[model samples]
Structures are given as structure tokens and as C-alpha cells.
Target: MKIVVQNLKTGKVFLADAPKPAVPDNGILVRTSASLISAGTDRAVVGLARKSTVGKALARPDLVRRVLRKVKNDGLWSAYKAVQNVIAEPKTLGYSLVGEVLAIGHRVEGVAVGDRVACAGAGHANHAEVAAIPSNLFVSVPQGVADEDAAYVTLGAIAMHGLRQANQQLGATVLVVGLGLVGQIMLQLCRAAGLKVIGLDLEEAKLDLARKNGVLIAAKPDDPGLAAKVAAATDGYGVDAVLLCAGSKDSGAPFEDVAGHCRDRARVVVVGDVKMDIPRNAYFKKELEILQSRSYGPGRYDPDYEERGRDYPIGYVRWTERRNMKAFMDLLASGALDMQVLTTHRFPVERAAEAYDLVIGKTPTFTVGIVLTYGPGEAEEYKPAPKARRKVPGKVGLGIIGAGNFAKGVLVPAMTGTGGFDVRGVVSARGLSAQAMKERIGAQYSDSDPGRVFDDADVDAVVIATRHDSHARYVV
Candidate 1:
């Protein structure tokens, strides 16, 4: 099976051909039809891949500071390597995919062959043709829910869980920061719940799109008096809840802007990346309640609970994150909301590289939702990258798109073992990545253009470990 992976070093994209994953007894094998690219989480990932060593250190100054403190007790090189390894591991993109069940493992009941389902859990429900997903996280796709619509279920669930956390009543005023796909969906969900919604973002076009979708008030991120505008819209009382759906380099601190704008005792639900700085003055004065909205709710990050067969008692604790996914899908099936306008772009699996570049470039041409399509297939033999060097005596040609730390340290290094795959031509839009990868992997040539590497005859096979947006294009 071929999987799309990000090169942690150069931010170059690559396609890896590995053994087909075996289905666990509690999981099902899904032949994916469509997978959605989560731009926010993935964009942060691509940006990390483009950073230099100094930039990485600065990005994690807190970690660096902590490491410095530990280095006095531990060895300096040891702490640095530990941090490097943490950054070097490649991350899989896409947790939302709609696919047909090709096979089901024993103990997985209710689902059978040919059943269509939407899967959650990253890496398991990746942007690939086939995935092995645990039974508990898999939800059946109702006939009313189209494949494209079903692919967005996981994200919709995220918005749903945020709403549940906010506990807003009808006619309540709300604010959603970051009018990206997730924010936009939250706006619609808020509107459906009879809440007045205000959207915020840097892009006017996205604001305009949100306005069209029922957000009456859309404000720029840089507006000095933006919180005032939100307050004015709320009759000077402030919103009942503020949902943070934007991703940033800062720690996701809900006590900053939310504390000032929220009404006394108003709730703030954080769903995106933002730094959390608790100001005692504000909290003591207003008594604001800050809540973190986990992606999969209580089951999130619990390998034993979410991955293994250990579900919490349903009667005692209703609506786990997995249940939220079902609720969102059911809402879609019932026509309470629509996702057609949200999906903006579609690509086949082969054009995966272009998809990654689109996200990495942060292209303004098209911004909403993007989907990658895959046709049914078994383990297909990959034509070794054509441009890779096949006649280097014992060396082989390789093309890598992403040059992030993971690619540079692991994948690229793994490909360069003695008598193993030779690192040939490399492609990365970033000059630093291309140059750095060329040196580290001993590539015969390096180019900023992916086409140059793709078109090269010396390249044996392409290895794409770029961004989530590119997974579909390259696989096609």
C-alpha cells in the first residue's frame, strides 16, 4: 500500500510504498473513497518542516529553556537528540475519510462487507486508498449522507463538540475566531442552534463567505477595536460563549482575549491553537469559565480507551467524542445543515504533491474544504520513480518533496543506508530545504521545482511526505 508522508526536514512531499497494514481483530479494512484535508493542523505541520535549527529552537523557546535547565543535570547532546527525535517522527494527515468496508475483523459487529462508513483517528483513517480503523470510531454512513459530505463528518463533529461545551441557549450571541473551514462550519452550526454568530479572520473573502452563510458580523483579526465590535453587537454585555477555532504559534490560552470580551460567568471554548496565559486580575474580576474542547472529547489521547476496546459507560457519560461524530452525521442526514458549499476543491490521489504545495503555499486561489479521491485497488506495484538513477552501479534515484526535520533525519537517512536506496534528485520549494536535503542525503542534484524531479529519468520512485493537502493529488 502507498501512503503519503511529510518529509520533516525539507518540507518536500513523497509517496512511500510499504506493506499493506493488517486488520486488527477489533478493526475494519476500509477502501477509502474520499478524505478531507485539515488545513489548520496540517499547515502548522508544513511550516515546522520549513524551519531552520535556530528557527525551531526559537519556535519552542519554552522547550529549549526547559532543556537547558535539564542539560545541567543531563547531557546536552542527549536532550537535543531527544528533542530532535520527537520532531523527526513523521505525522499522518487526515482523520476523516468515507470508504467502503472491504473486510471486517472478528468482534466487530453490526458492520459487514460493502458497508459505507466514515472513520476517525489519524493515521488509521488517513488519506489513502485503504485504512484499518477501530470499530468503535467507525460510524455508518446513512444513505442520505453523500460520500463527500460524509468525509467531513469528523470536522463537523469537532464543531459539534465545541457547541456542546459552550452550552449556549437559543438566541444566545456567540463569537467564532478564525473563519477557516472549521470556523465557518461552527458558524453554521451556531446559526442552526438559533444563536447569533459573529466571525473573525484576517481574510475578507473568508469573512464574506461566512457572511453569506449567515454570519451577520465578520471582523478582521487586526482590528484594534474588534472586541468592542463584538461587545457592541451583544448590546455591551458580550457573547455567551467564544469558540476559538484558529491555529497559531502561540500557546492556546483561553484566558487572554476571551476573558475581556466574555460576559461575567460567560464560557469560552477553545478548539484551535492559541497560547493560554491566565491573568489572575481578569479571572478574579470577571469569573470567566475557560474550557478546552478536545478533538475526540474524553477519549482523545487515551490509547487504551480509544484504540483498545474500553469504552466508557454510555449511560453515566453520554456523548463521548465518538458520539459527537454520530450526532453531526445524523444532523447532516436530517437536513439540519449542509456541507456542499464548504467543499471547495477536489483532486485525485496522483496529484498529491500539488495538494501539499497548495496547503504549504497557503494559496489564496481556493480556500474552503479540499477532498482527495481514491479508486479501489489492491497492492499495486509502484513504477519506481522514473527520474531516479537506476544505473548508478549500486545506487538508486529518489525524489523527495518535503524536507522537514523528519524527512531529513529519518526517511532521507533511512533511504541512504549503505547498499540501500540512494538519495538522488530532491525537490522543495524552499531553497534552504532543497540545499539542506541535498547535503544531508548526498543527492546528486536539488531543485526547488517538483516537476524537475518528477520529470527526471534518473529518479526511481517519488517519496512524498509533504502536507495533508497533497495526499490526494500524489496518490491519484
Candidate 2:
């Protein structure tokens, strides 16, 4: 299948052909129809990935420390090779996608083949032609919700998780910082829950979007009367909670502003990328509580819950990531959340690079929910054709899955220089990558299905250059 990947060393985005991922025992194989680009998070990752090694190390000193520890414990040569391997591999992007179930594993239940579902999580619900998503991360999309709108389910879940962290009651006023896509959804969700919502952002266009979506009180962070506006909105007590949903290079100013607007003993929930430099005096005097909202909810980053499909009991954990997705889908079905107004742009999967450009501000456009649409006939089961045997003497037939950075930069280049190996086929999850690699390598065929490589009779050996999590599955 075709997948979108970015070169960590160069930050160049491209498509690659990868073998079709196997359906796990506790998962379903989804044929992707639409996936939403999380502008804030996606841009941040892309930006960081594009930076130089030194810049990256400076930006993430914790990761540098980990690398240094590895060098200390292990040999420097091993650490160097490990870092080289990681940088050489192309990283797959995207987390939220809506698709139809092409197949299901034996342990999968509640969802079946042909079910229209929204999938979440970083690697599980990637921006690829097909994804092997655990049952817990897949939520059935209601008939009323369109696939394009359903793509927003993950982002909504993120916002929902942050709102839940605040734990504010009805009629309590809450301030939402950064009115981007997540913040906009958060504003609507807060309104649905009967909480008074006030929005703050640097972008007037986003603030305008919030106002159109029924958020009455909105202001810029630089406004001199911002504190007064929050005071008036909350009847002089200030906001009961502040949900910081904006991403900033330096979050000190935003943190200070949020602190200034917050009421005494109020809660501040951080959902976006912001510096956590809290002012001791302000926090001490107000006795405010600071909480960080994990990506989705309780099950986030828990292998037992997400991967093993073990759900938390309802009595203890009210909302897992799956429940958050369901709640967002329910809101969309019930017309409580206005996804239509929030969806500002749509791009075909072929032009995904251009879509990223727009999100990163290369194209000066106001966008909220940018959806990537796939071509028709993507939901069908794949069947690989039998490969013809190599007729040339002393030549070995080669079929490769995952034509990303490692395949193109190292593997393919090495194979090309080798004497007897013939490049028979190249497959990627992304059509662009498959086609690009095929043309560059002079391969006989290029496909989006990995089964093609496995079934080819001419192919003497198969190469797996995909992500670490997929290595074992591809080998099998």
C-alpha cells in the first residue's frame, strides 16, 4: 500500500510503496478513505524533523540526554549506528483517519468487515492506504456522519480530553487559548456541555471562526483589556478554568496571560505545545492547579489498553480514547459539533505535499480542518499476481516493500551497484513514493500492495525497510 513519509534528515516529504500490513489478532485492517491533517501537531513534527541534527538536539535536550546515556552504557559505535539507522529511516505521519474495514482478525469483535470506522493513534491510524488498527482505537462512524467529517474524530477526542481534565461544572466560564482546529472544536464542545466559553488567539481569522461557531467572547492575547474581558465574561470572578490549546515557540507569555485571567483556585489544563514556566507568585497566591491532558485519554500510550485491547472499567475510568472518539462521533451525528463550518480545505492524497505546504504557511490561507481524500476502489481486498521467473542467467530477482528513505537512500542504491540483483518490483503505501521509486530504480512494476512482492515467482528475495513496529509483521 502507498504511505506518506518524510525524510528526517532532509525534511523532504514523499510517497512510498509498502507491503500491505497484516491484520493483527486483535485488530482490523482499514482501507483509508479520508484523514485529517492536524496542523498544529503535524507542523510541529515536520518542522522539528526538518531541522539540523544540532538544532534537533538543542530543541530536545531530554532526547539528547537519552542518546548520551545510550552512548555511556553501550559502546559509542553502537549508539552512532542506532542513531544513523533511525535517521536513515523515513517516518510515517498522520494519526486520524476514517476508513472501511477490509478484513478483521479472529479476536476482533463489535466491528466487522465493511464497517465504516474512524481510527486513531500515531502508528495505528497513519496516513496510508491501509492501516492495521486495534479494535479499541476504531469507532464505528454513524451513517449521518460523512467520511470527511469523521476524519476530525481524533482531534475532537484530543480537545475533549483536555476539557474533561478541567472538570468544570455547567455554567462555569472557561478560557480556551489558541483558536486553531482543536481549540475551535473545544469551544463548541464546551458550549454543548453548558460551559461559558471565551477564546483567545493571535489569528483574527481563527477568532472569527470561533465567533461564527457561537463563541460569544473572543479576544487577542495582546489586547490591553483582555483581563477585563475575561472578568466581565465570568461576572468578575475570572474564568473557572483555562484550556491552553495553542502551540508556541516560547509559551512564557501565554502562560502568564492564562495565569492573569484565571480565577483563584481555578484549574489550567494544557493540551498543546507550550512552555511550562509557571510564575511561582501567581500560582502560589491564586492557589491554582495545573494539569496536563494526555493525547486522548486514559488509554493513551498504554500498550495494554490500546494494543492489547483491554479497556478500562467504566466505574474507574469514565472515558478511554475509544470512548472519546465515540463521544465526538456522537456529537457530530447529533449536530452538536459543527464540522462543516470548521472544514476549510480539502486536498487529494496525491497532492499531500501541497497540503502540508499550506498548513506550514507556505501558502497564505486560512485553514481549519484540512482533509485528504483518497481515490475510489481503495476499500477492496487485494490479490497479488504470481511473479514470472527470471529468464536471465546469473541474475537474482528482487522485490522490495517500503521505498522510503532507507530503501531509496541506502538499500536501492546499494542494490543498483550490485552485479546480479534485478529490481523486479517496488511497492509503497503512497502512490507517489511507489511511482517515484519505480522510475528512479527502473523497476518492472510498482504497486501499493505488499502482497504483490510476496506472490511474485520471479522474486528471489524480499526486503523489509519499514518502521520498527512493522518489521516483524512484514517478515511474517
Candidate 3:
């Protein structure tokens, strides 16, 4: 299968042919129809990945800390080689997509082959012709929701989860700090919930669009009298909730201005990359509470819930990620929200680089919703994955069965320095951990099943890096 992959070292985006991803017993394989490129998220990700080693270290101190620890444990040469291996790998992009299920796992329920569904997950639902979507990350697409529209489901659920963070009444007002795609969707959600919304953004076009779309008021953060204007919008009640959606570099999101005029006890829900430098005095006096909205909802980033399909009881956690997706789809079907309005460009999978140019500000044109369409793709222009990491064939192919910290930070780095072993695959109890390890270590593939590694022809040696409790089972 051909998929879009970015070189971590060069930040060069292109199409590469690789073996079709295996559908887990808990997942399904889908032929991708359409996928949405998230401008804010994707740009930030690719930008960081493309930077020089020093630049990457400077940008991420936590990673640097991990490297320092590895150096301390394994010596300098080992740590350096490990870092090289990480950046040499390709990265998969795109997390929101709509596709037709081509195959289903025996354990998957309430879905079957030929059904149209929206899939979410960084590695699982990629900018590829095909995606292996886990049960928890995909939802059935209702009738009337176009593939492109449904591709916006992940972002919509993110916006919905942000608004859900704020405990509000129907008549309460929310102040949205960023008016990009997520902020745009948040507007529709707030309106659908019968709440008044005030919007803030640097782009006049976006502010104008917000006004036309029924935002109670919209203004640039630097606009004179912005606080007073927000005060006027709510008839002096002030903002009841503040949803911060600005990017990481945007240190000047008008939150301070709005903070001074907000109602007592108003909640602040942070959903984006903005800095968290709150003034103690103002918040202390207002007795306001600050909260963070995890991406999507309760099931996100939880291996047990997302990979193993163990759902949080709806009675306890009513609006899980899947539920949020369903609600967003319902709103789309009811015509209360439209993703087409935000779409500024549509490109075939072949032209994804052009779409990303606009996303990262390399092209200065006003743009949003760069949708990539697929129609019987992989004809030409696909190159065999450069330096196939999946199998070394006659070489010393090593398979790793754990992705815990010790494996990634210590043992893996030590092995890379040996220079003879081709790290073929990695397994983790948690799907994301395995995927993350694969990206960092340039593995052929990642899966929760260690049997794929043990049973493969190319794997000449296996490392039992998992917990000791599971060692006897694998060894036997």
C-alpha cells in the first residue's frame, strides 16, 4: 500500500510504498476516502520534526532530559547513535479520516466490511490510501455526512470536548481565544448548545466569518477596547467561560484582558498550545478555576480504553471520545455544522505537499481545511520505502517485544550502537506506545501482538523487554 510519510530528518513529505498494515484482532482495515490536514497541529508537528538535532533538543527539553539519562547509562556514543536512528525514520501524518471498511477483525462488533466510518488516531488513521482503525477510534458515519465532512469528525470532537470542559448553562457565554478550524467548529457547537459566543483571533477574515456565522461578537486581541467590547456583548455579565485555543507561539492571546472583565468564578478551559502563564492575583480575586480539556475526551491517550477496547462506563463518563464523535456526526447530519465552509483547498493524495505548504505558512494565502482525496490510488509515483526497515532479510533482524522506558531509553540505544541488528518490529501492550517506539526507532512495524514478531521469517532474534511477569509465557 502507498501512504504519505514525512522524513523526520529532512521534513520532506512524499508517498512511499510499504506492506499493507495488519488489522489487529481488535481493529479493522479501511480504504481511505478522504482525510483532513489539521493546520495548527500538523504544522507544529512537522516543523519540530524537520529541525536540526540541536534545534529539536532545544525545542523539547523533556526529550533532551531523556537523552541525557541515556548518555549517563549507556555512554555518549550509544546515545548519539540512538538519536540518529530516531530521526532517520519516516513519520505518518493525518488523524481524522473517513473511509470504507475493507476488512474486519473477528472481535470487532457493531461494524462490518463495506460500512463507511470515520477513523481517528495518529498512526492508525493516516494520510494513506488505507488505514487500520481500531474499534475505539472509529465510528459509523450517518447518512448525509459526506466523506470530506466526516473527515472533520476528529477535530469536531476535539472542539466539542473543549466546550464540554466548561460547566455552563444554555444561556451562558463562552469566549473562544483562537478562531482557526477548531475554534470555527467550537462556534457551531456553542451555538448548537444555545450558548452565546465571543471570538478572538488575529485574522480579520476569520473574525468576519465568525460574525456572519452568528458569534455574538468577534474581535482581534489587540483591538482597542476589546475587554469593554466583550463586556458589552454580554450586557455586563462578562464571559462565563474562556476556551483558549491559540497556538504555542501565540503568547499574547487576550486572555489577560478578558480575565479582568470576566464574571466571578468563570471557568477557563485550555484546549490548545498557548502558554499557561496566568496572573495569580486576578484569578485569586475572581476565585476562577482553570482546567484543561484533554484532546477529544476520557478515552484518549488511554491504552486500555483506546487499544484494548475497554470503554469507560457511559454512566460515569458519558461523553467519551466515541460519544463525542457521534454527537458531532449528529450535528453534521442535522445541518447545524458544515466543514465545507472552512475548506480552502482540496488536493489528491499526490499533491499533499502543496497542501502542507499552505498549512505551515510556507504559502501565505489564507487557508483552512486542506482535504486530501483518494480514488483508487497507488498507480505511480510510489517508491519502495527507502531502506526498508521492516525486514533486513539475510541481516541480523531483531524484534523487540516491549516499548517501556527501559527499552526505548536504555536497551534500544545500546542495541543501535552495535550497528549490525536491524530493529524489525516492536510490541507494546498499549498500541500508541508500540507506534511511538516504531517511529522513534525506525522499526518495520509495530503491533500489540508479539506473535507477529516471533512467527515472522525475517526475525532472527527476539528480545523480551516486557515485564518480567510475562517473560515465562513468551519464553515457553
lDDT score of residue 40 within candidate 3: 92
Q: What clash pairs does model 3 have?
A: 390-444
lDDT of 3 by residue, 1-476 (tens): 56787888888888765556657678898899999999999998989878998898788999999989989998998788677656555678899999999888888999978999998888788998878888899999999899999999999999999999997889998998889999999988999899999898889988987897899888887788877787787788778999988785546334575587589999988898877777788889898889989998989999988987888887899999999999999999999997888888899998988888888788899886889999965453264434443565556898898777668766887897788888888887544456667877678887666788887778888989987866997884
Show model 1 residue runs off by greater than 4 Å: 60-90, 221-233, 251-260, 362-364, 378-476
Ranking by lDDT: 2, 3, 1
In angstroms, the error of model 2 at 453 is 9.2
- How many clashing residue pairs are found in candidate 3? 1
Please give the lDDT score at residue 38 for candidate 1: 80
> Pairing residues by index, what is the TM-score of model 2?
0.84
Higher-TM-score candidate among 1 and 3? 3
lDDT of 3 at 45: 90
What's every prediction's RMSD, in angstroms?
A: 9.8, 4.5, 4.7
lDDT of 2 by residue, 333-370 (tens): 99888888988889888788898888888898898889
- Which sections of candidate 2 miss by over 4 Å? 378-476
Judged by whole-model lDDT over C-alpha atoms, candidate 2 comes out at: 0.85
